[model samples]
Each structure stands twice: as C-alpha cells, then as structure tokens.
Target: LHQFDPQDVNYNMPSVLQVSGPLDVKRVEDVFCQLIARHATLRTRFELIDSEPMQWIEDTVPFAVEYTKVQAAGTTADTDQDTTTDTYTRVNIEAQQLVSRFVRPFDLQAAPLLRVGLVDLGVQEVEQEAQHLLMLDMHHIVSDGVSLEVLTDEFVRLYDGEELAPLRIQYKDYAVWQQSEAHQEWMQRQEAYWLNTFQGELPVLDLSTDFARPAVQSTAGDTIEFALGREVSERLKELAAQTGATLYMVLLAAYTTLLHKYTGQEDIVVGTPIAGRPHAELESLVGVFINTLAMRNYPSSDKSFLD
Candidate 1:
C-alpha cells in the first residue's frame, strides 16, 4: 500500500452564495480578515484544500475589498429580502475566474469578492447602514455549500466579539469517514431495483442532445435553467399528489420516463446533487458537504406524470 500520500482528493471552488445591500467596505474587509485568522483552513492555502500539491495564500491581510456606493435611489422592494436598485457594474475578476477555472493558478485570491453594485437612497436606506459584502475566495477544498454554513456562523460569532470555538475536526477526516460507512443497504436496494426493472432494456430519455454520448460529465458546467410561474407550478404540485411523493421525486420520475422514451432505455441512472448535512455540528462550518449520488429510476409500466 502506498502510504506516502495524505488522503484527500476533493476540492472546493470560490463561490458567491448571495449579494447583499451595499455596506462599509472597510468593515466587510475586517470581517473577512478576522474570519480567516480564526479559521486556519481559510488562512492556510493549499494549491488546493487538502495538503495537495499547491499554494495556499495563508495571509490575506492588508486586503481591501471594494464596495460600491449605493444611494438607495428612492426604491422600495415588496419583500423584506428585496432591496431597491439603481445599477452599476461590479466585478471580482479573480473570484469569478476561480469558480469557472476549477484548477490551480497563481495568485488565487485576487479580486476576492464578486461585486453587486450599490445605489443611493439618502437617509432612508443608506443611513446607519453598514451594508457589507461578504467575499470569500474559498478554495473548493475548504468550502462547500454545507461547510459554508459553518464558515459564515463562525464569522458572525467572531464579529460579535464572542469567543470562537474550534472545530470538532478537520475536513480531511470527514472525507475518510464518508468512505468508511458506505451504507451497503442503500446500494443493494438500488442495484436490485435497477437489475429487475431494466433487465432487458436501456435508459429512458428524450433528450435532444447527444444522449448516446454526453459531451461532459457535469451539467453543472453547462445547465440551462428555466423558471415556472406560480400557476403551472401549482398545477404540477397538484398532479404530483397522486404518487404521494415529493414534487422533486415526482419530477425526476417524469423526466426519467421522458428520457427512456427518447433513449429507449428501461432503467435510468440520474446524477443528483445532495447536501451532505449528516452532522449537526458541521452545519455552521463552511466546507464541502455536497455529495453527488446517481439516482436509479426503475419505472413500472403504468405510472404517468398525471398519475
């Protein structure tokens, strides 16, 4: 056995989860610096997240994150979450590139915060407003959607002047634990389900593209999204009631059926993004807890979307 390699393979990419109202750039910068100091993982850089063969910019001090000056510009949003807008361009060149280029590069943390421009609303919205932008050029190794929760929470705790607690463990250990308990039960059930359902058939898909040979493994790299309005959405939900299944499960079934019709496959395997939130303590930490599972669809002869 080759014991020379420290065991970690997955890496996280820098992502801007959301855009907030404009804030004091200085304060926002302070918050990030403090967060990094506390979370050594954030401070320490690997050419990747694990002890990978890469460069990690351990210190990002003297970092100045730019903030747009929003005037609020006399706008009212119906939802409390929504803020009025007067637009201007914001850019985080390096930060943006980091997400797209999921590989190593020089000066990783350049342009750390992806920008969402600001507006002026005079005293109504801009006053006493420490509108801040939370910028994290987190390496994929250290930040995943689930672990991000942890990172954000710790940041808030430290900012609020609370004594920050150390993490129960590191990201590396979690990866090892994940592979250990392989939940063979789930695997066996899924395998049996597929083997019986499509013993003599193929996957069902009506995809117009290269269904015979997909161009890429990850559709995330190129997923074209569409929105459904409330009326159609409600209609689908109502129809989904017949299966006594969730809207998501029902939708996947329908999609699988369509794919089978198109591809002439009786059994289907779908790639699904699952949030690996198995642990409660890791909730507030920012790391990669996102795992992908191939969902097997073994549809019987009778079920339809409406059914």
Candidate 2:
C-alpha cells in the first residue's frame, strides 16, 4: 500500500457477513469489540523507524458501530403479503448499501484498521425474529482471507459466552522471532539450495494482448466465473493420481502448458501463493501469513498431459 499512490485502493479487503437471526444491538457491539481486543493484529499499525518499517500493537484501539434502518417494497411472490414484500426489499437494499460503505480505503497511520457496521432487518412476522447484516472492513496489511475465518469462529464462540484460551504467541512475537539469530542460522542452511535453483536470469512472459497496456495499472478488477464439468474434473483427478502429483500441481502444470502454447515460450514462470505458516502453532494466529513463490516450468513440445 505504501508503494502505491495515496488514493489507490489496492489494499482494501471488505467483507460482508449476512446473518438472519434476532440481534441485540448492545450484545452484538460488545462481542465485536471483544473480537478486536482478542486479536493483536487487528490493533497493529505500521511506522517508519530510521528508514525501516516496523510494527507496533496498541494496547487498545477504538471500536465504533454504525447502524442503519430501511423500508422498501419486498419481492415475495405472494400477492396478498404486501407488507412482507416491502420488508424483504428494504433489507436487501440496506444490506447492499452497507457493503458499499465497507470497501473504502483506510489510512495506515490510523491504528486499529478495522470498521464494523450493522443493518437491522426490522422483524420477520412469521418467526417473530429479527435479522441483520454485519459488515467488516479491514486493511490487507494486517489480515488475510484465513485470518477472517479465524475471527469468525472466535466471534461466534465469544458471543455464546465461551471463554477463549490465551493464544500461544501474537503476530508481533512471531515477527521478532523471524529476525532472531536462531532463525537466521536455519535460513542460512538453505541459502545454497535457493541460490542454485534461481541461478540464471529470470525470463519475462510476453502474453499476446488485443489492446495496448496502460501506463499505470488500475486496481479496479472483477472476478470471472466458470465451472468444470464433472467428467473433466474426474479426468484431472485420475491423471493426478496416475502421475503421483497433487490436484493443485496437476492444475498448475496445465496452466503452464497453456502459456507455453499461447506465447510459444519454453521457459515459463508462474507465481503461486502459499500459506506461510511454518509452525503448527501459527495456524490459529490471525495475521498476514501468505507468501508468493514463482514456479519455473520448462514445457517441451513432446510432453503430454500426464507427463
């Protein structure tokens, strides 16, 4: 985020969590605050010290909740239930608005880079229950996809009045340990292997494009959805099993093959992201534990899919 322009939205990670159940505003607020208090990463901030980046976790950070109520026509097919239709429509619109507000960029210096919003879905007459949508906005600097899941599970447990056991170590502690002498020695042992693997100059991939590339890349992007047929899925699995390779490796190899065909480049490099948690104990920690590794695959014209 620091490398990009101030207004760039590259590091924003907005998540919308919709739940249909009765919600007590005060209880929900308390639970949300407790969730932030429990995780040190949520309260961390980055700063420059002598031209080097460093992290510091605040003892406590401010937490606030914004609430909104809406009323609109509903979309239920029941012609006689006019009121029900309006309630459902209102809920849907409000939920969308909440999500829109959640995706805005955050200021790194503003510690406790998290925001929470609540939408009250009045009441459901049939069940005599209330529904709600909880939206959370976070910066990618401190949290990632896996960390969000960890937060959700803990939030549920805390809301149920279950006390959580203390964490073995916080993210900051792990950061300090990574730079220690013991860790450096361990890393030094593998230096020769990495040097040998990446000895040559890396090759750049030149993909054919219909349109000219922009001077500066845009952060705006959308997801493309596609589905694999059951037969194809099974075939891929069988091929992976026959070759003693995992499904991900099989898929990656196929991707490399496509690039080789398109660009006609024998030396191809593809980047894949991996969960960087080296220790079993780090699995439960909520923080940025992701690393990207470049895969250099040399595909020959004679190589078959199974090979």
Q: Which predicted model would earn the best lDDT?
A: 2
What local lDDT does model 2 show for residue 93? Answer: 68
Tens-digit lDDT string for candidate 1 (1-307): 0123232222324434443444444555566766655554555444444645653445454444434333332324452433322211122333344334432332434323122222222233333333323344445545666656666676566656687766676555565565564755666876898678656555545556845555645424555899999998997898678657789977787787777777666567888889877777656555567778767776555665444
What is the number of residue pairs that collide in model 2? 3
TM-score, model 2 to reference: 0.87
Candidate 1 wrong stretches, greater than 4 Å: 1-22, 47-135, 148-223, 238-242, 300-307
C-alpha lDDT score of every prediction, in listed order: 0.52, 0.79
RMSD (CA, angstroms), candidate 2: 3.1
RMSD of each: 8.8, 3.1
Cα misplacement distance, residue 250 of candidate 1 (Å): 1.4
lDDT at 47, model 1: 41
* Per-candidate clashes, comma-separated: 41, 3
